[model samples]
Target: MLKWILRRTTGKCELERICSSYPAGAERTRAVEYSLSKSKLAALKILLVSDGLNASDAANNIITLKGVDITRNEGFRPALLQCLRHISGYQKLVSEVTRLQKEKYSTAIDDHEQQLLKLWSLLKPARSRKTSKTKRVGELGFQGNDPATDFRGMGLLGLQNLVFFAENYNRSARKVLSESFHPKFGYSFAVVGINLTSLILELLCKEQLKSHFYNSVSGEPSLYHFHRVYCHVFCEFHDFWFAEEPESVMEFSRILELYKVHLLSRLTTPGMRLHSEFLAD
Candidate 1:
């Protein structure tokens, strides 16, 4: 029930407050001193200190402060409660995000599988359908006959991301698909899409997505938010790829690694979000 407040200053992470203010009757405890260095991961942990009170005692202090001094910190209780509430809500939401990401890509053509087909049909209406998965993937500009093979290391999430871009940003998706045919500059559209999926998944696993999602979404970040990000990476990377004009597709692996490093640098900046127009034009 004790909500800890932490404020980051230039070089130190210090405990700002305990329960907003000390309970009136509560014995005065000296300020907790914990110095934080430049280690980014260390900055994320909330310093939880137990001040001789049992867990239940800590929980009770939040509810009934009648005998204690409520006036000590006038505005703190509500604000601290709100912060804790947001953290709780974020934890639940992020759990769901992680769960969706971890769930292996199912090959069985379920409802989502059907959605994938619908996206393809919408994007490539002129392409004739073949009964086999390989032909359908080929029609979408994959390097190989079977699209499922590309998802081997990744999973359903990769395919889902591609379908989402097509469904949500039909014009942009088709434009990118067309760009995949850029005479000398053209690359395998489906393969690159899957590669972008892997790139995004790596970022998510590293928890680099938090700031982007927090700034972008009004509520908790969702699977759709992740897909929107994939769209950005797909489109933006295409732009980057062509601008560099690699001689052959053989440069893809090297260029992709460098691109990831470049992209992550931008994302690591404080308060950075995927621009809305990243899906446009």
Candidate 2:
């Protein structure tokens, strides 16, 4: 077959050929993924699905199976290892995000309560304690007195994303929160954060975020990486919502769909990396 001919003539396996032919990021990663998925070896097939795989060991096994010579193909091992880490790291991030999404927010959970309180403190640092929970939460754009209910759909994942943004990007978070108070263009901050979480979850579930992740991260993606993506989404949505200048909050669903469409189009590019300009500030 042509594959055998290429292997014998070029002294490289299909994976090596793919790796050497394409640069890193979406093109290389996607090709490597395809090569591994179609591999006849059971180990290679398992690698496609397994998480927490040892990249070095996996790379060594791959080299042995493919009869790659280290001296001649010295770059193959490290290149393959990087691809393996990225492939498996994506799966691990999805699992972690899914777990967080499924975890319900509970009043009894100290950590949950603490995170909620932290959000309040970060966004309303100047507010007095005398304000009722309903009124106070409403100011931040929660649907009701209890912000807990707003998190029902996204679970703790939503709350965690908000907290991470507030904690890590305090200035930008506050600026966005302040912008949410614009009388004519205003919207609920917490509520929009939860909605963005749904958007992020949808993108991740559909694997639409692969290009962004592959281009941005060289190693295995983690929950922190996922959270960073959420921050970018939230920030971008904030800008998009204001730029469109919709009649009111009633136009949110339509505007959100437009943003999603634009986002998807951008993700289709070869090396799309989602980053918030606000992060630089």
Candidate 3:
């Protein structure tokens, strides 16, 4: 085969050639992903599907199989290890996100109730605490007297995303919540947050987030990284919603589609990383 001929003539395997040729981030990570997916060896192929794969052990397997000389090819090991970490980390993230998505929010669970209350406290610190069952939950932008019903679609993941944003980016979260109350451009803050959570979960499930994560995180992507991405998307959506200046909330579906189109275009760009200017402080 021409590949075998090139391997012998160049004295390096495809992965090594890829590492030496391409710089780190999306391009190199994607190339390594493609190479592993096409590899004839079972070990290499497993790397594409397996979760929690040890990067060092995976690097050793590749080195032994490809006969890479560590002494001469100093960069190959580190490069391959990073790629493996990103690959495995993405898979693990998908699993964890999916698990959260499936977990239904339960009032019987004390932790869920506490997390829900924490979201209110972070966003509405000026207000006095109310029992979890109070109709006041609507002030945060739920449709009815109870906020728990909104979680039926996105499950516990929705609550977690909202809480993470409010807890970690308190100022930005409260700012967006205030913007959502604008008389003309007013929208449901909590509802929009839940919708964005679903959008992000869809992107993650489809593996459309690889480029962003590859460029942003140097190592394994965790739930924290995933939450940060949600925060970025939420902030971006807030700006996008007001910029559109629709006639009313009825235009939400149409506007959301337009925003999603814009987001997908950016995600496909090489080395794209989503970060909010609001987070700069």
Estimate, for each residue in 1-281, the C-alpha lDDT of model 3 and write its tens digit.
98899898999889999999989898999999999999888889999888878988999999999889989999999999998989999999999988998899877788988898888888888886756678888788988766778888888999999999999889888888887889999999999999999999999989899999998888998999999999999999888999999999999999999999999999999889997677733
Order of the predicted models by TM-score, top scorer first: 3, 2, 1
Give me the candidate number with maximum TM-score.
3
**Candidate 3: clashing residue pairs, number:** 0
Q: Candidate 2's residue-wise lDDT over 1-281, tens digit each?
A: 89999988988889999889988888888889888888888988898788778888888888888888889877877888888888889888888889999999876687887788788888788874433345567877788877778889999999999999998898889999988999899999999999999999999878888888888999998889889998998889999999999899999999999999999999989778987776735
Local distance difference test values of all predictions, in order: 0.61, 0.87, 0.90
- Where does model 1 exceed 4 Å of error? 1-108, 128-132
lDDT of 2: 0.87
Residue-pair clashes, model 2: 1
Off by over 4 Å in 2: 128-134
**Candidate 1, overall lDDT?**
0.61
TM-score of predicted structure 2: 0.95
Ten-residue stretch with the least lDDT total in model 2: 127-136
